[model samples]
Target: MRIVVAVSLFFLTSTVFAQTKKPASKAVAGPGQQVYEQYCLTCHQADGGGVPNLNPPLKQTDWVQGDKTRLINVVLKGLQEPIEINGETFDNVMPAHDFLSDKEISDVLTFIRSSFGNKAEPVSVEEVKKVRAAK
Candidate 1:
């Protein structure tokens, strides 16, 4: 009877394990998405469009898609200059997120680069660290 009970318990546990399996997630978004959700979402919105003249849209923006250095500088040093987005000008002060770790910044930057129809090269932590080390 004890042997039978043990066999039953093993089968039950095996069935449970078979029923429970993790589904695979899509491509990685890195820390960029997390940082954006935590900091930029309130103003930039989830769609990457700024609040009219307040915040600027990152979707297909020249500044966001034009130069890698420009984008990195904006992330590391913050952008005080007025930026034009979707035919509107936003002079808001974007506080510098330099405090974020290289990996976090890299992930966030990579997310931004690929999202909002703004397909671009991925930003790496090594690149971010290189930029930070320069200053």
Candidate 2:
């Protein structure tokens, strides 16, 4: 009888411990996110908030959410002229990221468009290719 009770208690404790175990977290970064971290995270910041007077913020801005071609050109050809974003003027020179592959550019741009509280369409690889070809 004592052996039976001990076995029952062991099974119950094992069941309770198994039930209390938490599931492992699955935190995976997408391809676009990886590209953004590698290239754009420095100036744009992890949360897309650029430096006050140096780099422009990517949050809810026309530059990020507006015309697709213009945005593509910004990455492909770079921007030398002063630009306004979120009511602030940023004249810093954004060197061309033309070295990045079309897919990488598309992914990074798509990530930016969808992230930082901006709800815009994804930038396709074909779009990046067209822009690069044109430039």
Candidate 3:
């Protein structure tokens, strides 16, 4: 009877600890994840793996980590025509997200730059603003 009670207590404690140890959902979502989910998730997908031949993936691509101004322009002016990324060609039209605020664009770009197997510098609001101003 004592052994049974001890086992039950151990299992209860283990279960409680396991529940407590689990990471929170919000904690896992970096700054721009919400924006990504709202505007970009549909085409880009939650994993940043874009639609085949239509949308290009954001993972470790030059489009995400390369020239900051160009990346910002892509967001502000939108992307069209055929572009090759990772040896794959994407010819879809990514409509302008110019309506989004500088902060939103900055946060989203920063999030993209950092997430999805991408490790790059975060984009600033000033950078987005500059790119928008250029266009």
Best-performing candidate as measured by TM-score: 3
lDDT of 1 by residue, 1-135 (tens): 999999999999998876664222323444578788997788889989778877888899877777766788888899888766777878988888888888888887788888989888898888888888887
lDDT of 2 by residue, 54-116 (tens): 999999999899899999999888888888887899899898999999899998888889888
Provide backbone clash counts, one per model.
2, 0, 0
How do these models rank on TM-score, best leading?
Answer: 3, 2, 1
Q: What TM-scores do the predictions have?
A: 0.77, 0.80, 0.80
Winning candidate number (lDDT): 3
Q: Considering summed lDDT, which 10 consecutive residues are worst modelled in model 2?
A: 20-29
Model 1: worst 10 consecutive residues (lDDT sum): 21-30
Q: In lDDT terms, how accurate is model 2? A: 0.88
Question: How far out, in Å, is residue 113 in model 2?
Answer: 0.8
lDDT of 3 by residue, 16-54 (tens): 988877766656776688889999999999899998988
How big is the positional error of residue 40 in model 1, measured in Å on the Cα after superposition? Answer: 1.5
